[model samples]
Target: MTDSKDLDQVRSEIDTLDQQLQELINRRAGLAQEVADIKMAEAQQARADGAESAEVVFYRPEREAQVLARIMERNQGPLPAKNVAAIFREIMSACLALERPMQVAYLGPEGTFTQAAAIKHFGHAVLDVSQDTIAGVFNQVESGQCNYGVVPVENSTEGMVNHTLDNFMDSGLQICGEVELRIHHHLLAAAHTSAADIVKIYTHQQTLAQCRDWLEAHWPQVEKIAVSSNAMGARLAASEPGAAAIGGDMAATQYELQRLAENIEDNPDNTTRFLIIGSEEVLPSGNDKTSIIVASRNRPGALFALLEPFRQAGVSLTRLDTRPSRTEKWAYVFFIEFEGHLRDPNVAAIVAQLEEQSILLKPLGSYPKAVI
Candidate 1:
């Protein structure tokens, strides 16, 4: 049995540790502010030396990823590594805000998973701007309205998001980072509504498909309506007495709806991967992934030829998907993701070989893999 005196002593020690931690964190924030000041001074000096506008970039995705990785690697604690990394992530985010506040754009009418991904990657210190469409999110970052944007790339169950892929074909924005989020969908209803009152269900088309098996097993007779977004469905359910919405926790909390059924997705391991977009190119982190769009000439074994270079270079290909080419009929462009920084000699050599074989080879920026 533990004595009350020992417990009190432990609590007192914890309080002392907390005070020290707070002081160290503030000191870290001060150092970050100094880093910003140095960068600004350098930029000003460059402009004075006859360079066209030397804009200082406060955020470095690669640097932050490295820091998070180190934190996770060094952690030896009662708390989980991921939990510790998350605590450090918020600390870094707050310190970065002190250096220069960041605005991030995400697809939303509010309460979307994309919005959650943006917050997960950039931390809540960032000002989140909601856009109706994925393209709108990209445009926000491209037009300098937001420093960065978060958009869904693919789902484990639903495959690629074609709209996001198509936008990348023309956009000059670089991929700065990636985020993978485990999706747990819920069936939600207003406080006054009940399962017996749910005559109709509303959800985004993709989400509806994800929850199709569960819906068919339980609520087969209920009318399922697919809306533009899950957040939109939550809106309709809030207004209609006989309606319920299928969405994530964010949507339920945002709309003040109660969960009727939780973890209702057809697949238990359903996850979505989101890409962070920005104008600045990221330097190589130790662990990185490169994304590219390549249009191979229409010929025998063109697909094999396009991928052979990666195999030959001993580099692992992470993902490959095809999109219809806009310039030519029956021709498709390949979106290739692979494990390596483009700066690596072997990766650069592979790119050179691909350029020769491909009619169009666009090296979408290499970015650090998701940290948390």
Candidate 2:
């Protein structure tokens, strides 16, 4: 009887805390709406003054990054810092929706890792639209059909995603943010199917390669098939009786499949980096990365010439890759990423120096480094 009374008292305290939390969240939402209103009014006044680009932009990646960083910094939690920040993210996402609804596009048949990255970056309140291809994702954002798009840029095991890089060549979209998702491949099948019943396994070609050794060791006799995406493979697994698919958690849930095995990728540290493309440029978040494309004259030591400026300016280079140039058959363009915003003095000086040496230089916009 005493234990039951103690349980009831704890439950009562929890309910009281929940009520207080709900009130605070609503109060925070009211403040967000007020901020939106003020911005909208300011934008309207600017339009009256003949400003062409006085549109109210509600989503600020840098601001969100800073907020999340602060939240993590100040946490003294029984709950993990990341967990607390995530709860705040959904709160902010919901409050932002009260201000203005957001739409985001990602490459998908609906259950791809890119989609998961989108949710991670933007939160679940935003409407997520699925595009058939990476280019389609860019087009969606470029055309203003969606406010932003998420697309995979690189995989740890496979290197760069060339299709995503190619899309950046012609598109005017800016890189607003980035996300790094840990890739975990799961063996999934329909509820009625089991390991002994499986005849074929399906997954994306890249995924199949990631889990190659594990697959060879466990299911040696099973036929493996490559599909366009893991989500597609999940679809097949859901429909076919004797088929299983290697995919991530989202795919398993989306297709209502059971996980036969978890984290089957050969490389345990498998991670994929995704870029968020948008129409607006993101301001500096203290911690940021800038991406650019440069073309140099075909000559000896051209690579050194391009890289010398960054070294001279003391800017750290994070990534450097070469892509086939669309303008010249034999020439290639350099895709460079570094650790500073374009607005920084050293970064700006480096860009000026590169402009003097390179035939073509294009700034792809600086963005906040991934926080979560």
Candidate 3:
């Protein structure tokens, strides 16, 4: 205790330990990002198979609650809860920023999950505009109302968002960027109480659909009510003691409600992917993905001809979605998302061929692939 040099040595060792810890944490984060990138690629491939149809229009509030709770449970070390959330929040922000200062539109009434995802991708600093419906969001981007729009494309537990797909077919919008948000649902009751006394469950129609099987098994007799959106449902429940709503945790915290049940989905691997819409191209950063829409004549060989070029050009197609063309009764357009960028010579060549073969071909632009 009386030796100054000894104290100095101890401090120096502590400093070196701190340095090591920082390096170790950074390495771990880098690896996590890499894995996330791989998952995106796998999902794009999955979407191509029409298996994305499984979640075409589904939602599960309880399972989403579980994931966030687990994320909170696993958190440890010197980082505080807010700080850790902030880091991940920013990690997503940077991924969307590989192309910079993007303007994003979303379906919103404030506090909606789409709004949350929009911020997660573009950050609070981004220019955000919200419309009432998914189609409205696309229309805004299509009419140049916004630089890009953020919309839900698919959910792991539920299925594809047909409204979003339908809009993609009709509008000039194209998916320039993609982000996946692992949904965590919670039962937010207005007052602090147990689950037994709850009389009803409230949430968006989609949320109710996602958790349908789980809810039927547990609260079979409980009245399931649909609201405008999950966030709005939570807001209403936060003021009614016997009422409960399923929504993101932010809604619970905002309304000062109690979280009753967490992660209540039938599927544990539930996640939702979002698309970034823009009229022009995204400047690439080495890694990239491109999405396009091809409108074919409503004939027997139409779709086959549209896809043949990609197979011949050796272009790996990641997703192929067909939506009814609002233009006519039997008209339809094929939406395709694929690996590689427009800047790539091979990608450009394939586009040229597809254009010659199809009635209309729209390139949604290429954006940097998520570094994760």
Candidate 4:
């Protein structure tokens, strides 16, 4: 669009701009290294696979999402969401480098949703291990073999994962954190398949529950196979024609299986909540929750003493469950979840009162509630 003189002048300006950009990028990298060093102490001791720990901790997606959301709310930028997210991803990667690595355990044989959730929360920064059971996951963290453990607490379709609840009562693990994963299911097959030809479906018992109505109506005559894990079912389905597996999209892709159907879950809004447990206590967010197991002496006023403090503190009690106590007849452990942290003055005062009066008191850790 211009002459020789103009072209030369433009080239000179372009070179200047390139130099500035290079300097800015170099400065950013230096800052990242400096920040990563600070986080190294914590992340370094973490048990997650070394490479995963580096990436996940280094790039904290959740915190970045929160910050970028706030920035957009304020709207003082030329950056788009993706660009901003990317920038912060780099920044968080630096931040993670500042702390020691975190190790997280899960119930698994691999490619399980719990593993996915652990990765989601910890960012690929953790050492992910699949134990034989939920109790094992809890015990691993409790014994300090791992930094944290992830276990399913509840699912919208499956009610509660009772195995985890039972472990909660039996173990000394703290609920350090929580996360919800939006579940998506795929109909996977090893052989070529079509919806009309699929007669049998293989999946986990929980997955079966999620798709009960659909399965009953769609393939009433076919046998429903319950497998140990969705990935295992998917692997089975891949080897057999006329059979299909209900699992996440990743499993389907992992085996190079074609998806006969997607979004097969009956409820479009289904989600699962997972717990992160650690051996030690957690620092509470300003807005926090506390869970405790209260066992009172069989006397009349014992239960009342525990309830009175909560009422006085203006705490909202969300849940209370009575479980058979291991020790005595007619005695039960009343597991309670309430709004407020152990560190809150009012909550601490109530806990102190409960300690003196209750036969057994277990503080299950104060943590931020899952938002989504």
| Stretch of 10 with least lDDT, candidate 3 | 55-64
Worst 10 residues of 4 by lDDT: 53-62
Note each model's CA RMSD in angstroms.
1.2, 1.8, 12.6, 7.1
Q: Report the alpha-carbon TM-score of model 1 versus the true structure.
A: 0.98
Q: How far off is residue 299 in model 1, in Å?
A: 0.7
Estimated TM-score for each candidate? 0.98, 0.97, 0.70, 0.76
lDDT per residue for candidate 2 within 120-178, as digits (tens), equals: 88899999999989999999998999999999999999899999999988988899999
Q: Write the per-residue lDDT of candidate 1 for residues 129-184, one digit (tens) a residue.
A: 99999999999999999999999999999999999999999999999999999999
Instruction: Estimate, for each residue in 289-326, the C-alpha lDDT of model 3 and write its tens digit.
Output: 78887887767888788878778888788778787776
Candidate 3: lDDT of 112?
Answer: 74
Candidate 2, position 109, lDDT: 84
Stretches of candidate 2 exceeding 4 Å from the true structure = 1-5
- Give candidate 4's whole-model lDDT: 0.76
The reply for model 1, stretches above 4 Å from the true place, is 1-5
CA lDDT scores, all candidates in order: 0.94, 0.94, 0.71, 0.76
Please give the TM-score that candidate 4 achieves against the real structure: 0.76
Q: In model 1, state the lDDT of residue 29.
A: 95
List the candidates ranked by lDDT, beginning with the highest.
1, 2, 4, 3
Error of 4 at 16 (Å): 13
